[model samples]
Target: MIYLDHAASTPIVESALNIYIKSLREDFANPSAAHKLGKSSMKKVERARQLILKSLKGSKKDQLIFLSSATEANNLAIKGIKLLPSDRVHYSVGDHPSTSEPVKSLNSQLVEIPLLEGGVIDEAKFLESLDKDSKLVVLSHVNNQSGNHYDILSLGKKVKDKFPNIHIHVDGVQGLTKVETNLSSLIDSYTISGHKIGAPKGVGALFIKDGVEVETQLHGGGHEFGIRSSTVNTPLILSLCEAITAGLEDVITNNKKVKRINSLMREELEAADLGITFPFSLDDTSPYILSFLLPSISSDIVLRHLEMKDIYVASSSACSSKAKGFNAGFDAMKIDQSKHKFVLRTSFSKDTTTEDIETFVKEITNIIKEIKRL
Candidate 1:
């Protein structure tokens, strides 16, 4: 199949797979144990941590806590901070359910910032929500569904300018290893997923800036610098480190290639007279994700049709795909119900070739025309 669902999860890189296999075979000892085998495993975990820090341009002062997925990291970031006080949490309306749900669960007087039509949070509105009492402000650097990039550096500057004490938490799941994230100086906490950047699933990291007071989510042995308690999965961590370091090394060149292919796909769809809306044109957006509306078609139907042709894509966030009916993300964007029903998301990866784009466009064009005649 010509997979176009990189946003959901990319296939693990061969290098990462090799490291995973080797580590599983050689470093299977428990990191918490004090024996020689354990020490060797612990050493590998520490080395992986160093690689992750280097890849993220973080320092020893920054705390990198490994979790199962971005979802867990987000929950830890939000729920951990919410323990501070009531009504202290703020997040944009477009955040993944993982971030939004934890805040909702706390019933912590949430301040949902409005997003522009292009699906980016209004910085001014976000700033207005901050106060001395505000404990955390969670923002997704690049929205998962719309591919919209947020000017997090500018947002960070504004947040620090207004409320220097307020912590900024960024969910960088979509942006990690794809776009330049130089907000290390501005951001207080950042969340990244291993699978999104071609690492194995069930491995993710949370970056908490020095001196940030976040309560632990898991409670045993005080591992991950006392923030998370699980014994480190040395093999997965090493694989994640390898994938991220290798991915970031060529991210600039790879993103440009994907962007060109994305542009061609958009041009082809438009040239074929398929009704489409490119939301990113209205605001800061990522080049890797493309969401468009197809006239006279349901997203489910289109998805199935494409799959039948050996092409793969998505209708919304992978986390919410199993939910019945329309996605809450599209609803938040104010996508008209009719158009929402027709919306499809096509995500690109560095491995996505020009030939893949051409094939996708041709199949989509023919399918839409056939559907139009029905």
Candidate 2:
């Protein structure tokens, strides 16, 4: 079966899988315990943390804490911060639910930055809305639905220049390893997921700048440097580190390969003239994700057709796929509501091949034709 939903999760790398199994089998000691086995486990956990920092190019001064998922990291970034009732938290209009939901649950004035027609963040509008009261802003480096990429580096610089005190947070889940980004200055908090890059689920990391203070929401024995409080998943963390490090091995080449598949998909789909509307130009997107808009076809129907043929894809954010409603990115971009249920999101991984793209395009073409006749 051809699985084109890497945005949801990826297969564990062979090397990382080996380490995971071995760690689960032999290294079952709790890192928090004081015995010799505990000390050894703690040492391994710290080593894994160091590898993660190095892999992401984060500084030693930065605090890297593991969380159950990116959702918790995002909640900690926005909800953990000390906020006044008058303070405002802003999030990009195209943010993932994980990044946007936490802010919504807060008492602070929730501001949503608008998106341009093609799903690009309205930078000018965002700047106009920015003021001294906007204490924090959450922006995703790469959009999950449309595959639209953002120039966070430049935007972060602009935000810092205008409001030196405002905190800038990033959701880098979709961009990690697949896309290269410099996480130096101008970023206060960044969230990344292990599952998105071939590590097992239930392991995510948050990078908070040295001086930034975010209170812990999960009260427990006080783990993750007190940012997230819980027992450490040492084996999974080690496995995540290995996957992240290995995923970076041929990034430049991998990116090119994925982008080629994306381009090929876009080209043939458009050439088919089957009313497939690409929200943005192919070049404007990351190679990892592609959202196809079939205004005249039902995405659910199309999905079933592909499934019967042993191909898998997604209709919306994998995290919120069960919820039936308007998608934020599509809504923000003013896509026709009639076309809402027909949008299909397909994400490719470094392992996706040219033949995979060819088969996908061919099957989609057939599905559209078959559905119309029915």
Candidate 3:
């Protein structure tokens, strides 16, 4: 089967899988235990934390808190922030629900960041939206649906330059190890997911910059530096660190390879004369995800047809794939409501080969033909 949903979740690489199995066998002791075996497991967990922080160019003073998933990490970063009713939180509706929903839940006055014609954040208007009361701004490094890569570093710098105290939180689930990320001082908190890169699910982390204190979301044994509390899963943490190391090792090379694959898919799909139009431009978006509009067909219908052929793609974020009605994210990206249901997203990994794209285009072409005939 051609699996082109890496943006949603990816199969764990062999190295990470091996490390997971090994850790499960050897590091079975509770990390919180006072026994020697537990101490050994705790040491491994600390090593994993340092390694992950270094991978993101994070300094030693920064805190890397492991959590259940990106959703939880995002929640901690958002709801944990101390906000007053008069404070304003700036966020785009285009962000993943993990980021957007939490911002909405906050008691602060919510301001929606507008998008330019090309799905870029409106810089001038964004600056105008901020005030002395603006406390936090939530953004996505790489958009899950449209693949638009926002220049968060520059944007964060802009935010800090104007409002020195406004915190910047990034949902980096789709960007970590997939893009060139440096957790500079400009960003206050960033989220990373294991499954997005080549590790198993049920593990993710939040990088809180030094001096940014987020209140504890989960209260238990005071784990994750007291930012998140739970029995730490050593095996999952080791495997996640291994996957992150492997993914970061070849970001430039993997990106180049995936760019070719993305180009091939776009070219072949365009060549099929299937009335497909790419929503995001290749020049600006991540090569890892390609979203297009399928003419005269709901992407959900096309998705089922593709699934019947043992191929997989996505019509929207996997979390909300089953949801119906108006999509706030699409609307924020300037996507016409009329064409929202027709948009199909096919994301790639380094393993996605040219043949996979060719077969996908061929099968999708046939599906469209078959549907038209019916």
Best by TM-score: 3
Instruction: Give each model's whole-structure lDDT.
Output: 0.83, 0.85, 0.92
lDDT of 1 by residue, 1-374 (tens): 89999999999999999999999999888998999999989888888887787777778777888889999998898878745446577876677888888878875667887776768677677778788778678888888988988878888898888889887899999998998876458798899899998899999999888788889889999898888998889999999999888888988898788888888888887887787666556236688998888775788889999999989999878887876556667667767555666778999888788899889988988888888898
| Candidate ordering by TM-score (highest first) | 3, 2, 1
Clashes (backbone N, CA, C under 3 Å), per candidate, total 1, 0, 0
The reply for model 2, stretches above 4 Å from the true place, is none
Candidate 2 lDDT over 98-206, as tens digits, reads 9888888889988988888878888898999989898988899888888888888899999999898889999989888878867767889889888888888889999
Tell me the TM-score of each prediction against the true structure.
0.96, 0.97, 0.98
Clashes of 3: 0
Query: Model 3 compared with the native: what TM-score?
Result: 0.98
Off by over 4 Å in 1: 82-85
| Top of the candidates by lDDT | 3
User: Model 3, range 296-352, lDDT digits (tens) per residue?
Assistant: 799999999999999999999999897775778888888888988998999999999
Residue pairs with colliding backbones in model 3 are none
Better of 2 and 3 by TM-score: 3
